[model samples]
Target: MAMGNSVKAPLGHIQFCEENRSACRGRDNSPVVVKLTEARWNELIDLNTRINRQIRPVTDEKLFGKLEYWTYPRGGAGDCEEYVLEKQRALLAAGWPKSALLITVAKDVKNAGHAVLTVRTDQGDMILDNQIEAVLPWYSTPYRYIKRQSTREPAKWTGISDTRVTTVGSVGN
Candidate 1:
């Protein structure tokens, strides 16, 4: 897929860190920091469950040059990234703060990279994954998160792990 084919994610998830320091620091982004009351959180969870159904978990063509739409083996397929992207849009359409949503890249215990959505609440962070929509705790995921960018800030993110996973020659040009 080309640039035009690239789907636009929610505004809160696309922050540029250097340009939006306030948001990157996890401050002052309306969409990223939802002020949802307890009732709203429960409502959001319901909405997420409905949206999660549209996504199917698959592992195909992950290293194909630059992945555009998370594809499956049967020609057209969407992985967790595409699934989370669509889920975020659905919640936004249903009147949820985009800031309360996050897209995270993490490595599972098997070291396979995976993507999932994070929902911030007064209690703690709730995770929405293609594998399930029960909204689990962040630590409940058996994956080690590498980085995450909020929809409120497109370019800025945090929580990158060490580079030892790759060889030094793969680090720079």
Candidate 2:
């Protein structure tokens, strides 16, 4: 994805960072793109599939009775944000560089706001979505790319300048 100038992080993500400060602190020297090894590729695919099956897709309003409450799917259910966070956390615990796993916001096929995990590797930028089973290249997905966590600073975000998109602007959840 072509990331534009720095942009404001989604409100949910801002609040999430406030609640989980440690996760937001990324090392300045962490690799922005990962070296995609066969083993690491398998791990990404496996983790995406496992999380898709493990968490029931429930909106934050339904689960937390509040909007934009980013959290883990500890209750076996959560929204898209929860799935992304869980994947990011798991990958980090498995020794994946923090800069390589990013929290991304986008407009799905339906043009609705959605959260996903964007894994940046030497091969390409692949997306792990709760709504999709396959781990796909960011361009392969039908999202109108919005913004994502900066590789240099997880607490900051940058806009996505999607060449294929011009019709969509702004975000809603």
For this target, which candidate reaches the highest TM-score against the unseen true structure?
2
Find the number of clashing residue pairs for candidate 2: 0
Residues forming the 10-long window of minimal summed lDDT in candidate 2: 25-34
Count of backbone clashes, every candidate in sequence: 19, 0
Q: Which stretches of candidate 2 lie over 4 Å from their true place?
A: 165-173
> lDDT per prediction?
0.58, 0.89
Candidate 2 residue lDDT tens string, 92-120: 99998888899999988788999999999
For every candidate structure, what is the RMSD over all alpha carbons to the true structure, in angstroms?
10.8, 4.6
Tens-digit per-residue lDDT, 107-166, candidate 1: 766687677877776666777777765777776666666666544454445564533433
* Residue 125 of model 1, lDDT score: 71
Candidate no. 1 TM-score: 0.61
